[model samples]
Target: MNITFPHLGNTYIAAKVLFEGLGVDYTIPPLSSKKTLEIGCLYSPDDVCLPFKIMIGNYVESIQRGADTVLITGSCGPCRFGEYCELQKKILLSLDKDIKFIVIDEPAKIGIREFLNRLSMVAKDSKLSKAKKIKALSMAVKTINLIDNIEKECRFFAGFEKNKGEFARLLKTVKLEAIEAKGAEKTLKVLEEHYEKLKKIEIDNFKNPIKIGIIGEIYTIIDPLSNMYIEDILMNLGVSTRRTLYPSWWVKNTVLSGLKINFSKIYKESKEYLGLCIGGHARECIGEAILNYKHGFDGLIQIFPVGCMPEIVSKAILPDIERRYGIPILSLVVDEMTGEAGYYTRVEAFLDLIEGRKKLCI
Candidate 1:
């Protein structure tokens, strides 16, 4: 049976490796694009969060390419992500798309037990084969996850080195090697190779690496509709950004702690890092930015859904943060109508103002 997973950057990359190792074939969804968004926006409610639109588009396009199944890793939270599988299924069925969805629920802390179950589902037809597959794939997954983490960590500080593309290239190579290799030692070897190669580069052109702290709803941060790929936008505009949240942290800290109502978790890496706000996931945006500012970020950007209630609440107090920190800030609120050109235009303008000050100090 052919299987497929959505194009969620590293998630599917890791899944493709893990699943493929089990003797199952899987295809990743196509890279997300404008036409995908157009299709998604056509079927979605105008006011729903942007992630829903982008993911719907991902599914719509994926099924057209003979993709028989869609993979969904489950979530339990106040965030709308918890219902993505059910909602996406409803949308696909309403459109009469004959796609099948394979929803994979998160494994509990039983560690190896949870992994064993996942392995059995996708690979190993017989009991004996399953046992062997589990041992091999588990080792590979640990290696893959490690390489992925290293690459992600490298992204954090890549700005400190010149030719950020060089680091990006090495990261990709290391990740692919980890996925295809048989042993954890192979993973370690690839990582060491990349590290050695990077040390050779002079990297003297490393920019000032102004720190820009980003905070917002999970959708806006990851989903292009909400932020128009703001992270990339920041990097191109020469702003080295620090984002407080990631899926690992989301799963490890927020999800595992039992879904608390009314936003109680004090996110360690977020801009606010801890605090409250109202509307549009603004509380998170505001809190993350405040913490980031105190931590010495040169600037902060709060991204959120156009109508996100909590973010709307946070925006009200953003001026107070600006006043308190004496640092530059640019908040980008997004919806379907927000265009990429317009977003970058604003970012360029912000970068000009900030970079101008940097030059003045010299």
Candidate 2:
């Protein structure tokens, strides 16, 4: 099984660690770029969401390098994501590309036995003993959590760094080094070393900076290409940002959800506005808006792909939260046709508004 999967932020890094540790033949698609988006647009339905098109590009790129199996998580919800794997499989097959898909869905949805069976398919090629395989899984989990923590710190601290661009540079360097490192162990070491370096960077806690919370569709918010690297843009502007969704957070949430346990306090906060899932992360978006407001965020930016139903709903509800708490919220919708100049202009304007609001308080 020459496995390949769609990129979800830094999830690709952890996937590399997992596949390398398993000693399985796998291919990591080149990072998402304009070329990737263009290719995806060429083949995908014009109306499909942005993420679906980008994923098609990722699969085609990997297939050129000899990947025959695709690994993706499944969702059995009202959201269109649940239909992605099936539609994507058909799309590829229609083009006469022979490929297989292994979808790892929640144990509660697909049942625990089926979940393990699907997972076993990926490791069946590995010669490692059962214990070693388990160890590899553990290592991958640790790698993801460690990297996410590192990224979170870098983003939040970017606003306070005494040396401009220090956090951004360190973040880029660490990701490059970690990806270049051979095995999971070495990758973990690279992260650990840089984390120590991160602590040594000078930051001024007294320097108050604009802080924003990012909320909206999971894929668009987490994947850099999808959101046009909004987080990086914020870092460059010396703005502190926070978001509740990360690949690591998703992993824990999925597990807790399967166990019928509520893992996030955000859900409780959102209940007053949006009481049900309504598909996608709309509930979480509303919840995060309230949570960020209570935590004293200067503003909130909600990003989602164009035509996304759930976020369209959240966009409407956000005004209520803004009025109720006097927090500013900006909603940006993106698709293949979105212009870079216009998008950046809106972001900059939002920042200007936040700064003006902050000055008024002082």
Candidate 3:
């Protein structure tokens, strides 16, 4: 079956690894782009968060490219993510398309068990070499995870803009190179070689750096469009940045939440987010404010769709966080209407204030 997946940051890479490893027929919808966002926006309710648009784009793109099954994960929560796969399913059907979708409910940051099921789904009880497929996928996931870590670091270090977009491009290229190498040992060697090359590229972390925390709806925080390419804007301004949420965290929350366990851990992960239903990812975002203040971050950037209810709820409560924490948060609401000029301007102002303060500290 021709399979499809969305770009929820790392999962995009993981899905790629899964398909490649299993030797299954699949394709990645193009990376989240303006057109992708536009497709998502056109089909989705204006009130929902930007992630909806991103998910739709992947589904639509995949279907157009002759994809049969779209591999989606199930969500359970106040976060609304629990229903995303279902909602996207209806949306696709409404569009009058014939698409087969598999919603895997595997709960873990590793998603090892979940994705393996997809491979097995293709296998369909065929005694034909189950072990080989498992081994290949396992190795692929390991290499991909390693490669993802490097990409994250490169993206983080590339947060400083001394080298142009070279490092970020190299990071993606190296990941693709690893995927193509199709062997664990070759992937490792390529990683080492690239690491050496990237290290030699000069980047001054201290150059007018504005340490900032990215918060808000998960998709916008990770997917560039939903956030208006906020990270690139920050990098160009020489701001040191960190994304607060990732699939790993979500996977952990899913497993623990599924077991109805780890209340303390969840509360500790984001005290601001306690007492929220599964869909209420907003409260968790507030916890980021506290985390940032504790870690000496200069400012915070909150991203969400224009009418995202959960985030609007969080926004209502943010002044208290801003006041209590004494850190400025630049909350940028995203929609199709969000333009580059305004986003850059607000980001520039926020970075300027943070930089000015940093210089004063010295």
Candidate 4:
């Protein structure tokens, strides 16, 4: 039961902690890169969204490295992501009939009994006692939340750091160290130590950097490669950025949703614009844009894959928010054919526009 899962931001780190704690064999695929995208493109239907292709690539790459089981979360939303597991499984099985897929879905969608059954598939392979397995799951949850908080702080504080690139450098080092740490306990220690280090870095409290809110498709926004490392690019430019969608946030939202608890404040903000979930995180994107403006961000940037239906809906609605609030918004659509040079150029121009607007107000 050697396990592997596709990358979705820092979820890979949590996956490693979970597998190790469970005392099971697992493989972490190489970070998503040009080669990963190329392999995914080669095997995927040309019309499917970018995430599907990249995931196909991740699974194939892991398969070559001795992973026989793939684990992924299931969604039964209107977005195409809901169908990913079935399609991806068929795609992988065609290549290797012996491969296995375990999709962890909401108990409401798949029934509590079936949900436990799917989970047991992985747990049954673990040599740990039942209590130990539960402990591992708890540790994995803690790992994800801690890492996400660290990343959020680094990105938002990048602009205020007295030394340029300090936050970015520390962020890179923290991820590297966390990955190298032997087990769940050691990995948590590594993150906690660096998190303390992050606080000691000097910053200019009075410095007012161009603050931007990032909103878009979940996978594109969370996965750096999919969005062409837009967050890092913004960090380099000394821009403060905030994004509410993280893997940990997703986990909490899913659990709350299963319990019929409406804990998402974003949904309330989105009610005026898009009151319903039309599949994907479209409503959240709309809500985030409005919320950022209310929070006094200078601008907003929305990134999503080309031909993504939900994001396209959000994109169309964004201009209205821009007009009503008088805040600037930039939308970037990426695909296999997206060029780096042009993408960066547009981002630079958008920053320039926001800077000019700030100066005029001063």
Q: Pick the lDDT winner.
A: 4
Listed in order, each prediction's TM-score against the native is 0.75, 0.98, 0.83, 0.99
Error of 1 at 326 (Å): 2.6
lDDT of 2 by residue, 1-362 (tens): 79999999899889999998999989999999999999899889888999999999998888888899999999999988999998899988876567989999878888889999999999989999999999999989999999999999999989999989999999999999999998889998999999999999998989999999999999999999989999999999999999989999999988888889986889999999988989999998998999999998999999999999889999989999988898988989999888899999999999999999889983
Relative to the true structure, how large is the alpha-carbon lDDT of every model?
A: 0.63, 0.92, 0.71, 0.93
Compose the digit string of candidate 4's lDDT tens values, residues 180-213: 9998899989989998999999999999999999
User: For candidate 4, what is the total of clashing residue pairs?
Assistant: 0
Give model 2 RMSD, 1 decimal: 1.0
User: Candidate 1 residues 1-362, lDDT tens each?
Assistant: 56766555455545654565555656666768888889889888777877778888887787777666667776544456667788788888887656666665544533547645664565533334656667646644554445446545555555666665665567667656755665335545665676666567545553567677777776567554457767655555445677756544444443444444434334442344334322234545665676777777777777876766666666677777788668787888887788779888987888787777677862
Candidate 2 lDDT (Cα, 0 to 1): 0.92
Q: Looking at model 3, how many pairs of residues clash?
A: 12
Instruction: Evaluate residue 85 in candidate 4 and report its C-alpha lDDT on the 0 to 100 scale.
Output: 94
lDDT score for candidate 1 against the true structure: 0.63
Candidate 1 has what TM-score? 0.75
Per-residue lDDT of model 3, residues 28-137, tens digit only:
78777878877888898777666777789878887788787777776545566767877788888888567777877645533768766664675453343768767766
Off-target runs (Cα >4 Å) in candidate 2 are none
Ranking the candidates on lDDT from highest down gives 4, 2, 3, 1
For every candidate, C-alpha RMSD to the true structure in Å: 5.0, 1.0, 4.0, 0.9
